[model samples]
Target: MRIGIADTTFARYDMGAAAIDELKKNASDLKIIRRTVPGVKDLPVASKKLIEEEGCEIVMALGMPGPMEKDKMCAHEASTGLIRAQLMTNTHILEVFVHEDEEEDPKELKKLADNRAREHAQNLIKMMFHPRLMEKEAGKGMREGKEDVGPL
Candidate 1:
């Protein structure tokens, strides 16, 4: 199966790399198509192209919004576009976003981006190859970058 990874240059961390590493480890046979763009808003078009043109079954949209109000707004708009792309293609585009304002330390933010990407990579793997596994974990507050907060 083909998988797509769409990332941005504006991000402080290389989230796509982390997702690629996780996918390679867990699902090495997949044909991963990676596309890099200028910023978060570009991911929707890039991801759509990966699915419609490149024939990718699913995509991972990785981005890190800067610590600014304008950055957050851009992230929201990007997210809306991603949803629209998913509806248009009838495919899954995992939106993995790590906002810079989430943590005060740059080091922590980088770690969050890496962890979030890796975790979503696992989610993509499960979606493509092991849907039953995902169902089993339903309602479990499983997080990627930090600890998993179990379901209440």
Candidate 2:
């Protein structure tokens, strides 16, 4: 099984890395695949840079969008940060956590989270696959003896 740890601080990074390394050394059946730096709205760039430099394969972003009155700006920031990280690294997965209010119903929150998960999954898939699709198109054109094909 592949395992990944996500957290916000540099100490967390170091501790997670060490723990993952220890896990790999002690357990041959387990694979410590990635270590991700979780992103907050104000620290997105720094988190992305840490993930890229550490060669993490997945990122989990925590977005506290506040209430309906706040306009949900932090959610947008988290998504933007995830996109930026996807572009910078080999990250294949992005998990977003939504802050819940005390008065919110669990079932409603679950449904909303499910919808958001699907939407984000589609967006991420499109972003990740579009480049590969373009490359495939170029390759097909080249194979068909078309000289106008552009490089990927």
Score every model by TM-score: 0.97, 0.41
In candidate 2, stretches whose alpha carbon ends up further than 4 angstroms from where it belongs are: 1-4, 7-39, 99-152
User: Which parts of model 1 are misplaced by more than 4 Å?
Assistant: none
Candidate with best TM-score: 1
Q: Which predicted model would earn the best lDDT?
A: 1
Q: Which whole-number lDDT from 0 to 100 does residue 35 have in model 1? A: 100
lDDT of 1 by residue, 1-152 (tens): 99999999999999999999999999867999999999999999999999999999999999988888999999999999999999999999999999999889888888888889999999999988999999999999988789999999
lDDT of 2: 0.44
